[model samples]
Target chain A: MNRLGLGGWAILVLAAIFFITPLVMTATFSFWEGGDRYGFDSYRILLHSPKLFESAWLSIQLSLASVLALLVLLVPAMIFMNLYAPRLRPVFEFMATLPFVVPAIALVAGLSALFTGPEWLIGTPFYLVVPYFFLGLPYAYRAIDVGLKSIDLDTLTEAGQSLGASLGQIIRLVVLPSLRSAMLGSALLTLAVVFGEFTFANVLLFHTYAVYINEIGQHDPTEAAALSVASFLLTWAAMLGVLVLGGGRRPAVGGR
Target chain B: MRSPLAVFFIVLFLAVNVLFMLAPTAMLAIQAVFDDDGAFTLEYFQALAQYQYASSFENSLILSLLSATVGVIAGGLIAFAVLKDDAPRWLRSVVTSFSAVAANFAGVPLAFSFIATLGTLGLLTKLLKTWGIDIYAAGFSLYSIGGLTLVYSYFQIPLMVIIFFPALEALRPSWREAAENLGASTWQYWRLVGLPVLAPSLLAAWILLFGSAFSAYGTAYALTSGNIALVTTEISAVLSGNVVSEPQIGAALSVGMIVVMVLVLLASNLLSARAARWSVKS
Candidate 1:
């Protein structure tokens, strides 16, 4: 209450308005009864549609698969970076972030070109999983890297060695447990991104969750609005959950 | 113990990353140069001189620059207001949180929401029509290039805020306090101490924002429905099997985009490096 001045207030108010405008409009339009009638019919229609449920399932599966793959890839990679290649950390970090900076369409287009034809992996759910890994890599990598940095990895490893623990046992018992919060937070964030991602899903013609938004947009605007509201809530809830659970964790080891 | 298995996994990870990340981009460049018949030519690059393709490039660059500039200015203000100014703690936190969410909010959902608000049958449009103001008739279409920039700015502003906040937080509090204690005005204190310290980061962040806006396709495609021929949508259209069925042309367009992205990435890296040095010195 004391820190923010008039200027700050104005900015906050303006930002809130801008951010909420779309969500509010969508909710209103979805609920507004007009022409024949409305009420909750739009939502009802959305609920009854088998395609909506199917897409939701597909989205969940894809997100879960991607999250699992990211954990497999990132956990070891983070540990490796922490133990050996600290100097190359920034380069690896930059590479993970490359997908974000590149336009989504362009990446999809390039990927489509590279993998189309008899070589076409575009139709496979597994291919979709690949790009999802790239998209989720930065967040997961940063999260794990941060977590790994906070703990004394060298001492822990040595201590485990002295106790006659194998490398696998040491990683599982000492490292993995220590990184629980970071892993949870990163997984949640990755889920949010993969769930909402549309560009690749659309281009690849996949039945992921975001495809439902596009489909509803074309066929039923009202239903689409309802779906958007649901999505906004889902992603928002996931993000908040992560923050609440992982907020108090220490910053990544040696993080500025 | 630095086991051989650990070394093998590390090498394998790096090699796999290079293959996946660099292969597509390299393919783009290779396709741009060679036809299906393996004939190398400058035909695609020459096509850049044509009005259709040239205009798209020019429009993409201009729109990206404008949106990034506007986004950074607005974002910087909000960041400064939250971090440096005597703003309300709750209000600052709210703004920060909202911006983080909104920054990630783009593409179809964003476009659809805007259409609901401002399109011909939009909520605001209907309200304006009731007031006898035909906003559409006044030549304001939400599907135009300018309209896309406006929509893109919505997300970009929050993105800039996110990127710039940490850099702003790195500013020493004593610098501001010192300036204020010397009877300097608020504006002068910021101008002499804050802006100089933050300039490099600002530039780096603006480039990053520019790159993001430039490459963005979802909101642009959804809002404009591929009618607005920016580089991203151009590539999308080509790949959608619509305009150019030839994968080579789609590859060429993608290659062009990667070139621009790489250049932007390089510039941003250099700028960030400079900013890091300044931060260390201060």
Candidate 2:
């Protein structure tokens, strides 16, 4: 029964118009198979495109790899930071935010400049997991940091130690289970990044789902619009996943 | 607290991050300042003065500034409205969740959505034309920087709401009562108490939005197909140009971007410190 005031209602209405028009229009435009015709033609075309399947598969693989790499590198490091080297919190934080400075465009350019690696490292699409991991670092680290801060780590570790648990067991059994929401949040973020990523995949000559959509867009606007709707829904789902799973914490999103 | 295992993991973490994160940045700086002979040079930096590169930087600055300003004002208001005492819980939950999704709703899909809404023969374009308002004839092409500003603000506005809402919420209700008790009117209380406390967070959020817009590539690339001279697209052009692939010049532009980002980062850090102090006081 609370009121948002006249100004609030107006602002909200304007925001809704601004935000929803494009999405609604995109969906409408996708269904229009040109001039009084409307059917599932665009969706059919997109669904039948092998390129769509291939690239989507690749993006999913890359997302999994990136999330795995990110979790492996960050979870233990965060635990270590919280327990032992709290003084280095600022340094780690600074490092995490470093990716914000080097956006994907700049990172890819710098990456190409520094691309003297062995072919095995830079040749395959799997190498992209490296930069993807870097891209996810800032948001992922913050999510994990928030999780770590919320839990009583010292007490948990001491209790585990008194119960004759190994450090590995303590981390696996005592810490990570409590940090599930944080891990899920970071994983969802990495998923969003990998799925929506285009600059690196395009420049690096890998055809990700995004790059495929861009290609399809050039030849078929309607089909591309259809794919765009799907992509938007995917992003919404991932973000919603964070909200639902993170227990209403503000998910670290945006930038790049 | 200082276990050997923890030390080992910390060192490993540092090594992995430094090698992946810092090395590329260092390599970029080196490439920007050095030549094929491996000697120091400034030719690439000088190349940034050329019309294409200079204009891209100018265009980017203008676009980012425009979007960030609009985003902050509108988004700040939206946050304020959502956080008002009379606002309902459902409104807060919906706005928070939508902001989370909308903030991440950028890149190619965003570009496609905008195009479908505003491009020639687009749904809205056709709809408006029937009402006697030809936007394209009004020179409102979705391919221009102005068009990009409108699109960029979609994500930027939501991002502002997400980042600034917490700071706004941190304002204690008692503070307003304290100001009102001193005979200050609502406007006076906000001018003296609310605005001062919110300034740092607002500035920091603005800078963050600017950085986000400035470095964005996929949206502009997909929207204009690199027709617009954004620094990001320009870097892509320089690297992918078959006739004249100047990786050095690309490095120069990337370095310029890094410089601007570093400045934004430093300003953000300082502002965050100020905001933190304000939050602590409140």
Candidate 3:
């Protein structure tokens, strides 16, 4: 029988070391108190900090808003294309995937260069939903596309049409129900992006959760480390959500 | 005969994307060659040849190239090991899932993790000091290019594993068995049969990794605190209006980055498509 010999085990061990060491050290260092003393004082202070919850709440809200925006924008258009303009699939697919070429930093820079909007527009955090929606499109489109590919879209539409249902009714009553898992997966992917995105928040001066971490990190490394642990867990939770929900066929790429 | 509703929906999608997605990008390109008076100019593009801007571009390229190479080799090895016939199903699933999380577990938290592991007062640094091995004295700084490479490998390697695993999985065992029956040695079998099939996927993965590392902003910003010369940090610095207050230069830098990324991604897509063709044929 085939067996993983010495070389295979060795590679796995090295991977474990490489992957686990930073996490282990970071968790341990989060408890460091001055010289050699160790305690949970950093995390305690972190938990007590008002800004932590405020930033976290803002990030969560942004994530929800972005996901909602993504679904509303993508779902109807995707359904319409599938039902009527199927020939436009290639063009639509190209547009949906083009976001991959636009990095977050570049997008922020571009927006800043072009932004002649009102001061309040750049002043608030909610404006981030726009860029987050853009960043989320490629991933969400992929997930939704996979779902649309699997379902019998034409059959469902025809059945609803024969039942005297209107086009909008067919979408709402028949197709939307089948795409629930896909939408959820896309939402989770978008949630991960909004939660972890820093460049736009930082450059635009929005002070979202990742930007908040950068702020705390400047003076308090321990507290920042504690926050770092939380952020890592947050990403893990969202990624796991995507996997378990079977929304993303391929591993999703996140915003940096 | 497109329904009125479908036509409306399609138009709505196009309008939103053009206004939001395409507008900013087009504006960036426009600003790069345009002055404050809305007159066309190439001053900003010329300014990219300056030392600070030029070096940042050079550093970003070198960093991406180095990190991608390291990720490809290490991740390829790990993928091969994990996909071996003897590896348990649970182990495969665990590695696959871990790669998914780790690949996305980048940016600020990742920077903090590296700092806590390698910084002057970091856990491992202190431990190693007690053993009389001073990494700092040996000219190792976690804020430097080398340090960022190591930190980047954390995500890059996992990303490679995630992307490369499926390609490796498609490499059927029957091909290897056939090669062996044809009196080929293991190394010869791999050289003649395995590497050729995998070459395109490996190249595609490498380029994607390069693009990921090149486009990265948050992790580099957090770890280096803008100390390092990187296109991303440079773009952010200018946009922040504290470094130079030159929006045109920032636009140019970002446009340059966009061009590089577009080229890299296009190449990767082409190679991946070729790889997919082979996979299907096999």
Cα lDDT computed for each candidate against the true fold: 0.77, 0.87, 0.87
Q: Highest DockQ: which candidate?
A: 3
lDDT of candidate 1 over B71-108, digit per residue (tens): 99988887877774555567666766666677777777
**Candidate 2 local lDDT, B1-282, one digit each (tens):** 468878888888889778777888888899988889988999999999999899999999999999999999999999988888787779888998888888888888888888889988789999999999999999898989889999999999999999988888888888888887888888888899989999998999999999999999989989877677988988888877732747899999999999999999999999889988867643
TM-score, chain B only, every model?
0.92, 0.95, 0.96
Interface RMSD over true interface Cα atoms for each candidate: 2.4, 1.8, 1.4
Give the C-alpha miss distance for residue A60 in model 2, angstroms: 0.9
Q: Can you list each candidate's DockQ?
A: 0.51, 0.63, 0.69
User: After best superposition, candidate 1 residue A95: deviation in angstroms?
Assistant: 3.4
Chain A TM-score from candidate 1: 0.87
- The list of candidate 3 runs beyond 4 A from truth reads A163-165, A247-256
Could you tell me the lDDT of residue A17 within candidate 2? Answer: 89
lDDT score of model 3? Answer: 0.87
Model 1 per-residue lDDT tens digits across residues A142-237? 787778877888888888889999989988888888898899998988888888888788777777777778877886777777776777677668
lDDT of 2 by residue, A105-210 (tens): 8888777777768899999999899889888998888888877776788887888899999888988887887778889888988898788898889888899999
* C-alpha positional error of residue B191 in candidate 2 after TM-score superposition, expressed in Å: 0.9
